[model samples]
Target: MVQPFSQSRVKPEQNLKSLSSFNEAVRLLRESNSIVITTHINPDGDGIGSELALSRALRYADRMEDSKAGLHKPKTISIINVNPTPRNYQFLDVDNEIRTFDETRDAPTILQADLVVVLDTNHPMRLRTMEPYVLRSNAQKLCIDHHLDTSNFADVYLIDEEASSTGEIVMKVVEELTSHQIDAQMATCLYAAIMTDTGSFRYPRTDAELHRTIADLLELGADPTYIYDQIYDQWSPNRLRLLGNALSNIRVLYDGKLAIMTVTQEMLSATATTDAETDNFSTYPMSIAGVLLGVLLVELPDGVKMSFRSKGD
Candidate 1:
């Protein structure tokens, strides 16, 4: 969810007021007890982090209020994502709480939820496995995202495309809604979203505010060394082989303007690359200086899945 005036040169504070509905959405989300948090299908770090971080912030704020008011309004937090996230985020807080859609699981009913915080995704229908439950949920919906195209389905939308990732947007949103200062764990979670989405700060989307946000994250205890060591530096040999096979098929097209790489089913079997291992393989071609766009075609059982990336704006 992005604010309409997000791309303007106006200060974030001024732009923040541009979306007057943001606070309203936050308020509505805060008042609810039974909550469901979700994101788009084929979840990314930004999506997963924003959904989880927002959930934790809201739950903490409500519990704190209960403690102060002497009314134990402990809320039930159930996070249901369309699909599981990559192995990289397995260590983040509340990762275990993230449930895939299952009618049989005694998971809290979506329709019964007092609120649903949809993060990092504009379109709810893209939620795939969680669509049935989401449609069934009577919960008031709020959206927080930075994507360009968004569904206005949420009762309230707080979208800002200027922000590098939903994690960055959620950071500001959390700051506004809670008294808790950003901690090491929270910084790590938010940093993961920003780091991955911004191409480790090399994307054209990176801005002064993004750098400032990261500086604060580091001050709050984000360790780039550790993050890099795990995310990229520690790639397994099989993962290397998987990329090798895919790169072997890369083809230059449109007079070398497009670098296309196709991953067939046979390639997956040959490298023993699990679905998780193939994550982020599409980014490899961006490292090539002459390529303007990188295209990855992954052969699924039913059809081919494509991931497109471009260096040009």
Candidate 2:
């Protein structure tokens, strides 16, 4: 669905022929006065975590390395989110550093950037209300994502579809940005990103490379059990009730090849459950042998949010 070019798209790997562009990107960041970084709308953990880690790396290098004969701290790097994240990601504490801004109120701050880095989004429309500022910013733009389906709207776009998660891309960029080892906080951020995107190491995307990276993260202080507990263990009693209702009301479609569940506004009100609690409500159907796809139809105040997940053949 990307435009501005045709079937002859220049892949990131293909574009890596010149070290000049790569050096230009790093230099641009190194010279930027004020940076405003953001991710696609509905930022998942991978996007959020990458923005934080990247900013951290840039700042770390600035703090330790002097730009002109070791005399400057670089500029400020601001991380913004198009919208709030799912509750499970709250544990990341990205709110403390990156700061989330409402586009309605903070238009000026968004437009006045020397550099804009958009993460995780493939389609340009996915940038949401912040899209205008991204376009208007005379500042350079960079795209760091893991989706092959991307629009080269930025100057430096490093995308890798083979990556298990955007966090992996972030890891590579972090190493390039700074040689410093991953700290506990960095490991925690990365672990959250990789774990969620790869379905806790259960997704088919999880390969040896992913495992090796995760092992390195573990040595750097990634604790799977604790992070899993924080991400998945916390549940409200009403959420349990909602889960039960969802499982009971689910239907097998496509002659038991697909499973479907619907969460009406009434169901939400009845169980005192918010939208976040229904994260895995469709998984019950996915566990069934014949079901290859599980779809959840959630009715919101205005419209509906549809979630689709594929399992087996």
Candidate 3:
């Protein structure tokens, strides 16, 4: 199962150790002529949003430089991912620039890039089949992530586990790149990334600063109510039936402290739903009154998939 984007947050000051590396990353971006940007497989909001925002920022910066230098050649900035963007996130890819990786088709593009920016996750394994090709490339790797690094594969790791989301870190980098200018598109993507990862500003890491950042995003043309509805409210009828089918199998355990819900392929077929429609199904069990921990078991063709959500440590 895909993991939730939310994680523990450290103080922002704790990330100061990577300041030098962050500077190096920015310098590399300035020097590189061709760049490739990628995120983890089955990317969630943070990964996709950060990638889009960074792509836009880099292109804008490149255009600005071209204008100043009186050069007409364009910098190639490719935003490729191991998995196709999900339906819900297609709105964020306004330019239709995001591409799905294919070994034969995208291999040359990945290899020829002067720099590759891996966002949201530092682990190379998250790159899936593209990991080997990325490793083979002579391109310098830069990671901008909020997750704790278990493996250091990138040449420059601009990691900040305290960041509310990778988009938050990308926001700062965009500011540096574009001289503190964030357009409506950048604002919308970053706002969605931070909002979803912070559980709609209800999560533990959502501080006053984050709220202020959100306010800035709103001022930049991010519509809070509309974005929220686009992400959460536009569920299909089949999805609602699938949720009902899963809820019908809910069971209590350990004196109501634990709740378990199971959804089989048969249930999906019966409800005329697909795995995509079942997004956030794990949250249902956690919403039970006395349930401290919720577990969702989904039966897929490969095997049974499990997701766990807990209220406390």
- How should the candidates be ordered by lDDT, best one leading? 3, 1, 2
Ranking by TM-score: 3, 1, 2
The sequence of per-residue lDDT tens digits that candidate 3 reaches over residues 1-313 is 1111222343445434456666777888878889999999988888998999889999999888888888656789999899999888888899999999988999999988999999998899999999998988999999898887448788887877777889888887887888878899999999989988898988776777788788999998898888788778888888888898889889999999999999899999998887767778888899999899999888888998888999976
The predicted structure with the larger lDDT, 2 or 3, is: 3
TM-score of every model versus the real structure: 0.89, 0.88, 0.93
Q: What range of 10 consecutive residues in model 1 has the weakest lDDT sum?
A: 1-10
- Compared with the true structure, the alpha-carbon lDDT of candidate 3 equals 0.85
Each model's lDDT: 0.77, 0.75, 0.85
Model 1 residue 249 distance off true place after TM-score fit, in angstroms: 3.3
Best by TM-score: 3
Instruction: Give the per-residue lDDT digits (tens) of candidate 1, residues 56-138.
Output: 67766876788788867788888887677666776665447788777667234787888888888888788776666676678
RMSD of each: 3.2, 5.1, 4.7
TM-score of 3: 0.93
